[model samples]
Target: MSQKKTVYIGPFIQCKTLTDLDICPNGMIGVDEGGRIAFVLRDERGRKIPEGDGWEDAKIVRIQDHGFFFPGFIDTHIHAPQYPNAGIFGKSTLLDWLNTYTFPLESSFADLATASRIYNRVVARTLSHGTTTACYYATVHVPATNLLADICQTRGQRAFVGRVCMHEMSPEYYRDESVETALRDSKACIEHVRKIDPEFDLVTPIITPRFALSCNTESLAALGKLHRELDLPAQTHISENPRECDLVRDLFPESKSYADVYESAGLLTPKMILAHAIHLTEEETALIRARDAKISHCPASNTALTSGRAKVRKMLNAGLNLGLGTDVSGGYTSSILAEAREAVFVSRHVAMDEGDEAKLSVEEALYLATRGGAKVVGLEDRIGGFEVGKMWDAQMIGLEAVGPETTELDQSAGPVEVFGKETWDDLVAKWVYTGDDRSTTAVWVGGRLVHAKEGFRL
Candidate 1:
């Protein structure tokens, strides 16, 4: 039998937060396509197994002088077309931004070169932030959107790129093909980019109707039918800004709420992803969660744009499948760490004001950024957590340089060399509260090194 390479990450932290903080040791994790604790044990014993089926011939991989490795961060919502204008479009609230800056900027994507440049920057920035997978929204230009899929496929990043459809009610500069044309473009875009690499696993297409206001019922219905027919995921904004929600109510008065508008059009299914689900009523929340639709809690974006805070704790208690998203341009950062931190912050503020004070915690925020985001994008079992039999998409955060006094670890680490022997929870807490892209020294996807801080080559 041929030999398959064996890799051992030693003395590194694993988020043993899954099974038992008691059973998990701060030792090692072995990763191939899937992670196995047995592999880690063998490596600690100085055994170098073969790369393939011939385990006797395997060679051991030792990563020297680094910190812990955990599952790669996932961003449940981002806009590839808005990368360039990230901080520039922060002038106004949602609708105003959409009309003035966002619409004009997105209109530029019709130029393939422009799209290529922007998409390249978007991919690099997200990767640099240790986001191995992202659910991205592209402009209404189908060709430009497909260019995004191509870039993601080549980069070996797992992504869901949506070809946005806007057949009516958007600013002239941003609206796209008519209902029939939007449907056709979405279909063509999906079929064209379904397979790029041999594995045909990197890129997937999603149908993105801009929103209830931008899409006529006919267009949304057609997109919904296409969503069900192709078994593709559907994503879009909903109840983000109070004004936007008002406009949606005005447009779809026959519906009960923004969520109902989508439901009436047959788009409220389990695979649908709704971004910025703030301002949703209790009934609306119940309806969306009932259908198993997921919410991408973009706390930074909501707060930065002056949109009201989402009741994330309430949604969680309602049993909603929720995840964290950077929402990039609006969020002002690409790091999912920032997402987690802000999720905890905003949820606590909301909970303090509305719900009980015990609603939000740092651990819950971390869950949203990691496992929750993975599940929302339909990649939970494959990409999230350090569980066995899951794809090896993870990042190593080097917190050895951080002082325990700088963090909550002051209480946990006692008097010893605080950074020397840290637990998975210690590493995670540092990453969420104190770390950023700068803190991520190494990253891996599918068991292959993608980004390293001046170490191994990609």
Candidate 2:
């Protein structure tokens, strides 16, 4: 078991802050053992009102005058094996880029030693970028996938890792064993790591079908059955590119649409997360909402590959569970704030051109990054908000650097006064528009300080 620790942080802000509406002026979340949270509310006498263990008199360890702490961002679609290609850009479409850059780069994860070195960098960078949890797709290499899973578990970040299962029609070098072998290996991986307590609990084995074109009908059906039998979450790409959609149509002629391919195979369940629902017909949208599945919007990747904008506003109106993703490598950066900004910008652009009856709001986007994302990963009840009794998975962004006061002063005074105007919405707006990894000064997962900038280690 990991060591027990208690820490306090303050002078922060959060928009739509979840602590309370009555007296709680800001979102102040507390974390205790097992990554649990205890939101503090003081009585009239100023005595601490407790929610869980170690609530009273917890020692203060760090203080940030201009920090805004909120629930850490959750990435629902990213490739751990593709970490080496984090900044690969300038592609016109998905299939073209996959062939030109993505596949060639993914094939490298077959090396376990190589995976070890890369996984560390991926986690370090992701933590630095304020992502406390991620849903990662590793290569079919079981050992390499295992290495990646182990790193996430030991390092105390929530991760849903799929052992990149693919049985037919992929590049020879990157493809995995037969369907039966893939199933058995995936099940074994699930049971293997689930025994390691918190780290293992943080790690879940998701059944990943590379895509419709990559997996044969038999393979998709088998994995779908495995997900139902094991009660596990499943993920895959869907309707991401027009060419890929056409390929899916050619591959599965009987299906009316691309979404039907998975629906027919019994994979589109509430437990499933479909990445990039950029090309959904009304029927597909109905089915998606009916099944309660989620859409993982990768705005950066969509624009980077010219796949067109996802109907985010329509998806939300249809009552679909939706979240944002960097789709890094495909996306140039791992910042969810960047994803949020692009999500709004692209949605408005699409609405203007197509004149779709949908609008995206800043509050809606922030909700997607937090609660909507947690739902996509099947952790909505336990990990999304700064409420009492939720997991204390939070991050602190220093708003001091990007406030109005800095602009008011000349470059001589060091500009420390602007931080006071950094309200929750102001902080988040600045974060979405101007922030990067440097803005993230501290990260805490399950009540433990996992990442901090300069001279502090947990």
TM-score of each: 0.88, 0.90
Q: In model 2, how large is the Cα lDDT of residue 232?
A: 86
Q: State each model's CA lDDT, in order.
A: 0.76, 0.76
| Residue-level error in angstroms, candidate 2, position 250 | 1.0
Task: Please give the RMSD to the true structure for each candidate, in Å.
Answer: 4.6, 3.6
Worst 10 residues of 1 by lDDT: 409-418
Pairs that collide in candidate 1 are: 3-51, 3-52, 4-51, 4-52, 5-51, 48-58, 49-58, 50-57, 50-58, 72-394
Off by over 4 Å in 1: 1-4, 11-23, 33-52, 56-63, 197-200, 355-359, 402-424, 456-458
Please count the clashing residue pairs in each candidate, in the order shown. 10, 1
Clashing residue pairs found in predicted model 2: 35-446
Looking at candidate 2, what is the lDDT of residue 64? 62
